[model samples]
Target: MTVPAATEGTANRPAPRQNKRNKPTGVDILVLVLTIVGAIAIAFPFLLILINSFKSPADYNSTGPLSFPGSLYLDGIVNFWERVNFPEKLWNSIWISGTVAVFAVVISVLNAFAIGIGRIRGNTWVVLAFLLANLLPQEALLYPLYNMFKAVGLYNNPWSVVIIFTVIQSAFGTYLLASVFGTFPKEVLEAAALDGASRWTTLWRVIVPISRPTLSVLLIFFFIWTWNEFLIPLTFLVDNSTQTVPVAISVLQGDRLMDVTTTSASALLGVIPTLIFFLIFQRTLTRGITAGAVK
Candidate 1:
């Protein structure tokens, strides 16, 4: 049992390499270039706004909209902040959006838990109804909602906005959370049941802890949606003092139509909260989206 020297040498030699084929092709390069160009094009307007937000009125008017500012200016933002009564609107938006986020998350989690994990009878039909409701345009429901709120004396109330946004946002939140919870581990739920844990206990202690990523996503979404909502708030909270940031900023535009710098500055200020919120929870948002996609 000894091999010949030539056979031994050949056996010891490395195997021939397989073709490496992971390099980018022309199509991929073209796609990358196009994507970059499209992103820049999309971002161009926002970039212009940001640049103009720091420019003086004279500079903004004298220079091209896309030109650099002669100097950084805070007068526009200061004047806009004072004129718009930013504090009052910011407070109104914070409370309304916060309430909506909390209530929506709670309702959505409960609905999703029952429909997704409990597997209650006729849940499919309920989900179908939600999908249909989601498909309905907001404008279609606006007049009815306005009339109903007016009849109930909620037409000029911040709480009205809170209630309306909570209900509207919860539909989508439940749909998203249901998809995630439906894929939960049945064994874990069964073990909880065998331990004599109540459904409420299991949901609060087990399911909720495991579902934080999805919940974070819903919370951020509801906050941003409510904060940015203009139509509902404008329709209901007609009192300028009670208006949210978006409505107030819009009013600033009409009142100061000639002042582009002030308008741009206010617009930039209005979006800061949402941008900061997303940046803070971006990791959880990514996880939630990936989890949903995988399921």
Candidate 2:
């Protein structure tokens, strides 16, 4: 009995129970691998374009699209800026996109509030109508929209493009915000009402603050789409002076490496703001899309 009472040494002590944290499942590892591969696949093209933007014309031609340029050259950048009237175009695009985003967000927010608060009766039908409208191909509506815009004397005007993009994009934004709003707690609205808050007061003071993620998503999407828009602007604004960056880039034509370099540089400049916007609002963008997909 005395021998059996010997104390255990530190090394002889049983190991502490393993932490309860679960290891990554096989499915998780598979998903992680797929996500990495998919991300690299999508990013490679942009990486190539960015690298090529800095290359000399000769280096660009001799190198593969995926290859690194031998050295950076300002010639491509210089030509892109000079030929495209980059400053003017950039300023114009800023105004166009900014205005569109402002108007779209304003209108969409109002729409979302109306539906989300039950002010708009038959909201489901309204949402369905918008979905149906978007389902129809753009080509189907071009002639009709053009005829109407022309009839209204909006042709060759920047406003024509701005207004068109706002209206066309509203359908998707409305759907997006509506879905986001659906995930909101109904009890909060009831509690506000019980606290003697008016509908407008509750929305402004409570709902809007909580809805930041969704609103940020809408703002960024509308901004990028309007900023990079080409077809609508081209169709509406026939004059070269009103050409958007995408349409302007298309005019850089020549059967030479220099021309290609110029085009790539112009494209790089055009895409810079979109990158900035996404980087700024990326958190909301991810959360917004995932809100309804999960519990």
Candidate 3:
């Protein structure tokens, strides 16, 4: 019935001390401050755009860029949308960017497979060629491209922009993916080969499944890049109905002067779709980043 000396003392021991509020260290406070400032820095532009997007010219003139609007104004947005033929522009962008993303990823996969996994002779030169191609300025190619497309009767066509960007974007993708595939687990490739998988079969069923995250990230990047591309799209898609959002926005600016609010609304509309796309696939991008860090 009697407790041991150690057990008896345990019953009488002071209750575990409650957690105390620890004042943040200087380092912690500095980090907190930096994070707040960084967030505000990043978010301020979007906030400004959203605020000004809702302001009428009168409200914006009265209060300026920093101030919030007194009343919501949807007119600028609606007017810009209609004026720009936004629905057509939106569809054009989606089609071009989507097509470029898919084509670029597929081209990249094929190129990377040849240079990296296949370890074909002269792959270093091939990869270097890809890198150099990416470094080549769009400006340098413009006149030549224009002449070529015009000769082919494809000038001012959306497909011209599509073809140009698909090649351009895939060049970068090939360079990046070749490096990734160069470090691919050799064991897996050997396993697939040992299983009597043909080279084509191994690439699609084995390599692609493993590389999906990276390809997803590349696809998203290619889509966003193509969506935001101005020069080629503007050059190749002269008609209002064929223009992408960026080209339309630029055309809107050059063709007429815009009051601050209308300009802000136009910019906001341009930014929202890509921002939404990024947010949607952000987690996949994160995974792709870390996939290399671990097994």
Candidate 4:
């Protein structure tokens, strides 16, 4: 009886697993190794820039691009500040980017919402207008708009740049937001209306909350675009104090050519804020994009 019971227990045991299928093929292993190498290759420039940013300009210029500086120094930073007035430039960039992003997002959102839900007259025409704005080359409008601004006494003002930037940014932003707003479940919105929510309330409490991901993506992209903007600032603002980082970098050249070391350091410095912005919003940016796509 004891032997029979032991045999039954042994029969109930599972078979041993196969190691063959769990192992990677030679090709698979090679692909993984190549992928790692490719990623490193892509990342090398950023690593080089970051490391070189801490070096003194003299040390950086003396060393090969791949070599480390003998002594880390703030000379590059000091030169960057004196040459560019970096603080003022950075502040101007921040202010302009923030203002443009806010107005663009708000105007785009409201326009999108109205077109998406209002069932108003000339909706198709409004969309067509947005498309036309996008189709026109910005350069074509530059001369005409410059003239218009001159007539209106706006050509050299920051307000001119701000308004133009907002309008230019709004075209694409409106299109993107309108697409997002269109994807919202009409049934849910109808239900909210039936529950006695006003259009403003439904928009603020319902649509906006559900649309966070799309909005996040738009905010990050818009801010980055505004921050890097150069031509518009150059066209509008003549004051040195009001120049954004990109314009400042352009003028980093003295009477002759730009100082290579100082300009390199300034270029490196210019990359920092955009990098910080991306890092801060990366998680939301990814999640929002994924959610928007799914919607």
- Model 1 TM-score (2 dp): 0.88
Model 3 regions more than 4 Å off: 1-32
lDDT by residue for model 2 over 1-295, one digit each (tens)?
4434346465578889977988999999999999999999998877877887888878867886667788878788898888768777777788888888878877777777777566488989888887787687777878988898889998888998888778777877777677667667889988999999998898788888877666777777788888877777768766657777776776554322455666678778888877887888787789976753564
**CA-lDDT, candidates in order:** 0.87, 0.77, 0.92, 0.82
lDDT of 1 by residue, 179-262 (tens): 778989999899999999999999999999988877887898899888888887877888889998999888767765647888
Stretches of candidate 2 above 4 Å error?
1-16, 20-29, 63-66, 182-184, 254-258, 284-295
Candidate 1 achieves a global lDDT of: 0.87
Candidate 3 per-residue lDDT, tens place, 114-190, comes to 99988999999999999999999999999999999999999988889889999999999999999999998889989
Which scores greater on lDDT, model 1 or model 2? Answer: 1
User: TM-scores, in order shown?
Assistant: 0.88, 0.82, 0.90, 0.85
Reference-based lDDT, residue 108, model 3 = 95
How do these models rank on TM-score, best leading?
A: 3, 1, 4, 2
Shift of residue 243 alpha carbon in model 3, Å: 0.6
lDDT, model 1, position 135: 83
Distance from true position, residue 141, model 1, in Å? 2.3
- lDDT at 252, model 3: 93
By the lDDT metric, which is better: model 2 or model 3? Answer: 3
